[model samples]
Target: MNTTDALEAFALTWTGDLTYDVAPSLSCHEVDTLATLLRALGYTAAADAWITKHSRNDDEGDAHYVTPAAALREQLADASDRTPWVELREEEPDAFAAGHMVLHAGGRNRFAITEQCDRPSDDPDRT
Candidate 1:
């Protein structure tokens, strides 16, 4: 799929903000969608790295397997240069202070989603 298509896919499955007050988090399914998009964009290595980094288990068994994509949700939203793999295009919303991010990697527009802060709020950091 092309960059636009990948972005659309990401948006469609986006979980948005799960916590109202705390930092936003993405669901496992949302993270997996991004991983799949990475592979589709020819970033198989990056995709694998992401999945491996996120996967975890309490009993070290498959029964309770989980991939918490929370930490990087902020990282991606902030578009930190700490990870050199993805480039981000941040679009501030026209009305509300809410924004969206489009991630580019492996010469493809692979991921896009409405940011966790995509809104006007009383929080000084958010506005």
Candidate 2:
């Protein structure tokens, strides 16, 4: 399924429960799509944490079997309220503002966001 469909399916079915044991099982692609959607909705930290837990190798076993960190759970809970999931469903992904972060999954499933350098340079020497 496309990312939007995946996202809508997740949002519609999610029970708002942060308990890992109760968390819904998702395919690797679904996990990637959810993480990408979360990042698009500006919940980068939660997305990163969720992806980190779920993207382990098969030998490592599924991390979803364990409870998520309290902070991660809190982040997810907060994000659920703040994210415009319904509105996003109605809009195309391309409609996101320029430089918005998008998650890309690859070998080993590392998380990366395109940096939007709107703030002044951090290096004092540069100024």
Candidate 3:
């Protein structure tokens, strides 16, 4: 299959697994956007809907956490069951996380990644 086709199919496999409480693998901007969306949806707190939402707001500058609102926590947990951001790490122990710190110098680390797949085969004779 073509690379795009394969990727689409693989994505379809998980898109159908929409578990509620799970958090999405969001970028920094996306975390912000989710807060905005949740706000629009009547979910309270930027902390409420920010799944991968995190920051160093602590006075010591060492604090980091994502506090989905109490109402949304169950939904987020359901989402975790569906898409499960944490599952990628469990399945991919050797996957390159880049840098040694939990969060890079910029304080950003991917909160989720979809299940890994074999590299697209380029050798016509091999597959």
Candidate 4:
């Protein structure tokens, strides 16, 4: 299969697997790659949706924590049933993440979940 087909097949494999909570935290590079691949595959809507989902807020500043809203959180929690290896990481300040739900999935580090917020509670209380 060609690159585009391969990507589509791969994406299809993770159909139900793609969700807010179980999503992966993508770096700037990963986002670019994903967007490019999606567009190349003619999945423009999907690409746009993915980017919009992961986009960060303009006023979020350089560093901040993000979390999903109630409805999305509920969906994510449900999605975790199939993909149990999901993780929610507080990304370091970077070019991506417009204060959205940063997810790490399919062994990839770049993917965004929508309905996010900037709040101190969004971070892990490791301290």
Candidate 5:
């Protein structure tokens, strides 16, 4: 699929109900292709996060899983890089602030993005 098509497919898979599971089973090549497309579309942070979360290091001699949030944090914390997730911050403020970006995995090799709540969890009115 083309970059726009891939992005559209990714967005179409988004879910708002956090209680419901959202995982897209994709191959390693698919993951790499998707990340590359995202980077081409100016989603550098998301692309890097995807790569970091999915990359397997043979040198380590064992597979290690990194959470999407952790990967995103690492990318955003890099001082040498330009501002990351500018479009995401403007488009999805709650998710951006909560460190919940597109393409997150609840388990190894499965990934999806969910809509985040804007309200504080401590608020009794929030459901």
Candidate 6:
């Protein structure tokens, strides 16, 4: 299939998120749609609802597997580099402050759901 077809297929299975206020002052927020993509790409565990005859285990993959498109991954990664989702600072100051920014710098997601962060090379000692 073409890139649009691949992205469309991937989008159809998007899981969105899960929300709960587990604490009085803090809420452990999580996004499950990304979770599904992560799982398929051999990252996170797929949701329990994915019980399929072919999947080795429900936690292993979704009801269907999606093969990522290299072109799409490249395009999304390029776009992310230009304007990172990692930079929602003012509008999402709390999220911006929670910096695990380095992780986004490098990863393999042939699918477009996740993109490798294109951070500039680091020189350890800044101070």
In model 3, the runs with Cα more than 4 Å from the true position are: 1-24, 45-127
User: Residue 41, candidate 2: how far off, in angstroms?
Assistant: 0.4
Query: Which candidate would rank higher by lDDT, 2 or 3?
Result: 2
lDDT for each residue of candidate 2 in 25-48, tens digit (9 for 90 to 100)? 555566677767777766676566
In candidate 1, what are the lDDT values of residues 41-98, reduced to their tens digit? 6666555545444443222353224433333454574454655887756643442243
lDDT per residue for candidate 6 within 1-119, as digits (tens), equals 99767755664554222211211122112233444554665533233223111122223144333323333443344455566543211122333332222223333321113333445
Which parts of model 2 are misplaced by more than 4 Å? 1-19, 22-24, 57-127
Q: lDDT per model, in order?
A: 0.50, 0.45, 0.38, 0.50, 0.44, 0.34
Q: Report the alpha-carbon TM-score of model 4 versus the true structure.
A: 0.36
Candidate 3, residues 1-127, lDDT tens digits: the string is 9976664564444233331233344444545655565455444443343443333221223223423232234443445555633222222234444321111112234343232224444544331
lDDT of 3 at 92: 27
**Winning candidate number (lDDT):** 1
Ranking by lDDT: 1, 4, 2, 5, 3, 6
Native-to-model Cα distance after best TM-score fit, residue 30 in candidate 4, in Å: 1.1
lDDT value for model 6: 0.34
Error of 6 at 55 (Å): 34
The clash count for each model shown is 3, 0, 16, 15, 0, 3
- Return the lDDT, model 1, position 64: 26
Runs of candidate 4 with Cα error greater than 4 angstroms are: 1-5, 14-19, 22-24, 56-127
| Worst 10 contiguous positions by lDDT, candidate 6 | 19-28
Among these predictions, the greatest TM-score belongs to 4
Instruction: Please give the lDDT score at residue 102 for candidate 3.
Output: 19
With candidate 2 superimposed using the best TM-score fit, by how many Å does residue 109's alpha carbon deviate from the native? 35
